[model samples]
Target: MSGLDNVIAAETRLSEVDGANGRLVICGHSLDDLAGNVPYEDVLALLLPDLLGPNPQAIRADLGQARVVAFRQLAHLDAELAALPVTEALRALMARLPDGEDRETALLQIAAPAVFVPALVRRQAGQGAIAPDPARAHAADMLAMLTGADPGAEAVRALDTYLVTVSDHGLNASTFTARVVASTRAGYASAVVAALGALKGPLHGGAPGPVLDMLDAIGTPANAADWIDAALVRGERLMGFGHRVYRVRDPRADALKGALRRLGAAGGMDAGRLALAEAIERDALTALRARKPDRVLETNVEFFTALLLEALGFPRDAFTGVFAAGRVGGWVAHAHEQIETGRLIRPQSRYVGPQPAGRAA
Candidate 1:
């Protein structure tokens, strides 16, 4: 009754969030079995099996072309929209995409964040927006647009891992918001915009950026234990240490931590930074165990989500915007599925207001 805890609001086939067991399955595959092993292009196609035709490779190429189209069509609005926050600006830009629940429209939704987020970041920094090249892969194009330079192979792999790991996660707050709007028969754009609004809240998509901030403040391995203890004493919640759903270590955290190590091995990231993060994770876990005792309080996705994105060249503030870029595919697919097979996501509530007076009893 309270905020629908333990409530099953709607049915889904896109992904499963097994919070009790710390597992995430996207379209019948474990997240670890998918993330870096499979390309994001194929992941989205699998996520929307009905929407995509039989050719997976062609679907991948079409997604590339869609990114080019989105970039060219919406790149002109930078000055008019730069004042909004990055995620808001991204929502505004994507809302302008050609409307429908057709395949092209779905592709546009997947392509929108990859196109607009970098443009917004560059425009905000007084840099010109980089044009998308349809020949490159999705994650590579995004890194290029954000930085105006091609990333090394290692960096591209790191980002691809992050994207696929986060592509979908059961019916999260934002995904549910998208489903609610979609159930009303609103178009996919409306649903995605609704999802974006939900994702902007700190309790959801906002923690990754702050995780990097915490690491920066801690600065080095020597400072990890003392800094964490003092921060906990002052009652500050560590940004990436806990998750609402997971009672065990978040599976995505381990996935991204492995990606971070690979990036480090390939010389794409500094070894010292990775070492500092390890030290911090160790300290944070130990302190949390001593203080809370009963709770698991292990690292969640955001801990290494920050490390992976930072290594791949995303600015801290633009983290959520980038997250939407990855997640919008799931939103698009979920909305379309809800349209075909789901009912309106309306729910009734128990009355808590003051009751009318019983007159003349």
Candidate 2:
């Protein structure tokens, strides 16, 4: 009924999306609690308590080594695959990975995006791919691979906050798509690829790029109120202000905003741009509250998400892929959770068409 809204599909222990309260809890920890405080690999261990080995350090080493393996295996260019968009290129390249429900496949999927996305970026620019450095941490290595030099401490710190904040969030569209595929006992690769396809749509993972576009258009803080009025007059949806869930400010948005500030203090952020983003958020919030008096429309993940990822040196187009790099861990965990259910996710359908050639019309 109504696209299965309010339907309880499956019970999960990984993450909880408390849209009513605008809270996100991962493995019994808050998004605010986990974002900057925990390294990404530690969060990975927390999500997969049973799967990861006893030594968390070894698991970190394993993931680091896996990134190296993905780098070696996938760095060589396939013209057509490299020519695809970053997320699609990742999806295509993932098709070649050894597919399974085992830990090995899960580990590879987690690491592949970090390698594959930058490779796609390089090949698009007619440059060579950078090899992974196993010694570097995941967030650092990912940025290092892009810049061909070690990223600053704040840059890696910002990226780690991003990856952890987005590591898991209830059953979003992409996570749901992955679980549906996994429910049928398809391999992890199939589920992840399907999720990537679903995330490619604008309503979901394609949001952050346009947030940047809006920023580019506004240019300065002085323009915020005027731009808001004109956009509302033209019936344009403000890119980063609303979310399907979250009646209050998205907690992730707050987390990323804090990260943006940290990066600013580290000298990677532009002061004027930060001021402009904050001004627009304020103006947009006021306009939205006045427009929909009964509904809450506060800044969602896309707002600061665009700013944080842009500060991290990713192109607008690669934002989705960078998102996948962080979210792939959750996809793998959700796939395993769905598989444990041991039931196919076959939802019922009702049709309103004329029945049996007008026999019941």
Candidate 3:
């Protein structure tokens, strides 16, 4: 055996990720191309074949309705529940959604994050939530609802790009958790909750906020190298650099970095943070390469995810919550796929203790 005991079946239906080549293709289109051209909701439709049929307009309409319903549910949640951290609140809200056994239910489950997570963030920050607007595109409406201020065109576009870029990956840890949950015939909510729990770890969706923390400590471009070196000396892993899957550079990093630049321009944010972050990326890569020549350490998506969310007026604490809003689509789709396959996922564990003696009885 090659030691991959989990029996992850490789697929070629839509997206294919070649980690060794550092390439990602979605719907027979390169990630770079789709990230530039497609809206977030359209990409969601592409990823979910059953929930969203061939008609893009109809899918958007259905998703809009789902968003409205989910938003109302979010508004009714008690202040005590809303006081929890955005990520936990989001998971709780998602857990309450019905199982996606049919098209309508699946759409509702997919739309929960677009509605609830942003509302939870606003509520936690002492801002009242805004209801979803069916007329507006999903990403634009989400930003407007969360911030209670209409974002500029470029800002909305940037947010859309980010959401589309992260909508799905082949089978990352969180997606795998989602699939595993679905394989057991659990409801859509359960799978998404499992994904969210995995995402809460520092190694997954938790990395972006710390990138901002690292930048705050560094304070300026001149101190970037020293701060990184000091942190490395103390056995700290740099927050936004390097990825487990990609060898050369993460393609998502470029897409998000572009979005961040656009959003920064729209928001009139000072470029100092961006510049310092770039310097840190370069220095971190160099230092990492010097220390371990054989390992591939390059800039990953979290690097620019920090800058983008900060520019979009999100607090550091809300980063992972925002990620859930994008990834919930993928989790729902994966859950449906696993459920359709109807497999019970029960992986065997190797017991380390002494084996049962043949004559024990």
- For each of the candidates, the C-alpha root-mean-square deviation to the true structure, in angstroms, is 1.5, 1.5, 2.4
Scored by lDDT, model 1 comes in at 0.87
Q: Show the lowest summed lDDT stretch of 10 residues, model 3.
A: 3-12
Whichever of 2 and 3 has more lDDT, that candidate is 2
The per-model lDDT (C-alpha) reads 0.87, 0.87, 0.80
237 Cα displacement, candidate 3 (Å): 0.8
Model 3, residue 285: displacement in angstroms? 1.7
Residue-wise lDDT of candidate 1 within 130-243, one digit each (tens)?
A: 888888888889999989888988788888888899899878899999999989988888899989999999988988998888989999999999999999999999889987
TM-score of predicted structure 1: 0.96
Q: TM-scores of the models, in the given order? A: 0.96, 0.96, 0.93
Clashing pairs in 1: none
Which candidate, 1 or 3, has the higher TM-score? 1
Question: What overall lDDT, based on C-alpha atoms, would model 2 receive against the true structure?
Answer: 0.87
lDDT of 3 by residue, 1-361 (tens): 4446345664435567777888888777788997756787777778776667867678788888888878777656887778888888778888777775578777887777877767777777777788888887788788888788887888887887888878788788898898888888877878888999999887789889988889899988889888888888998988887777788788999998888776666654668877888888888888898876888888888988888888877788878888888877777777877777647777787776776679573
